[model samples]
Target: MQLDSGAVAEGRVTRVTDFGAFIQFDNGETGLVHISQIAHSFVRNIHDHVHEGDTVDVKVLGRDERGRLDLSIKELLEEPEEIPRPRAIGRQSPQFEAKLRSFMRDAKERTTAGGKKPTTPTKRKK
Candidate 1:
């Protein structure tokens, strides 16, 4: 089958290079998938996403001036699902609540004993 421009099909990753991967289709037509086109996100290392002999669905981005097919793995694949990031349980340190609880207890005890405000240690700088 002729690998026409704008066609999307499954291909096998014949080889991977620092720049891109060479995808050889079932019809023996080969194309290069540029690193930027490999994924929607930044691809620091191509091996992190694709390896040799791996099957990938690719989109034909048409031929260059020399007639070599330009392919994009990102275009053919479904958009990656956005993963939820970890959010802070509260707006303070993990031990903040514990420290505040202890301070409150100490203040209450001090008030009952002498009705005086709790004094915090002060740093002396020369």
Candidate 2:
């Protein structure tokens, strides 16, 4: 049977991989559910959610440029967010943000550890 975009159907999970799952329908049509599309939340492991021979509901996203069936499971479960998360005021970084936070904490500790004052130098005789 020909698959149409936005069509919902059930299929057997024929193959499961780290990146995605291959599902084969009774009509012999197969589609891919990319790892990111496998769940509403982050999907670190595809095997945790599905395995080979399991039946699953999928929605046809559309044929890609190569004509392969692009499917989704998470989209059917909920609507996507309308707005993206905001970044830091002046920077966008994962590593830098973490490192910056650590550095700031250490600097604060050093500043607050004040305990002594430096002695002034003596004046020389003319």
Candidate 3:
């Protein structure tokens, strides 16, 4: 199978690296899907989503002059069905609960170790 510049293809994950995964295209061509290109959302760990020997559908976005195939798995996903629009709501983005808990624990530790309020200044009597 001849691989074209903009053809979608399914490939097997041959190797996984810290920065990207090497996909072996059925045509015998291989390409790297950078960690950033793995998902539309933040990817803290690649292993959470993909593993070696797993076959995944990928879209060939384009290729650089160097002939590297740029692929996007997220783009190949079927569009999620749209639901009825909800009324406008005032809310902040959900916090990273794990990170928030860590910060709170650190703050408590600092307060206990220092034994003083951060906002109160120590005063010296004249």
Clashing pairs in 1: none
Model 3 residue 4 CA deviation (Å) reads: 2.4
Q: What is the C-alpha RMSD of each candidate to the true structure, in Å?
A: 11.1, 12.0, 9.7
Candidate 1 residue lDDT tens string, 1-126: 778899988899999999999999888789999998987777879999999999998989999998888999888767768833556576788598789989999988977767766677999999
Estimate TM-scores for all models: 0.61, 0.61, 0.58
Query: In model 2, which regions exceed 4 Å deviation?
Result: 79-126
Decreasing TM-score order of the candidates:
2, 1, 3
lDDT of 3: 0.79
For 1-126, candidate 2 gives per-residue lDDT tens digits of 568998999999999999999999989988899998987767778999999999999999999998889999987887557533545477569898899999999987776666445457999999
Q: Pick the candidate with the highest TM-score.
A: 2
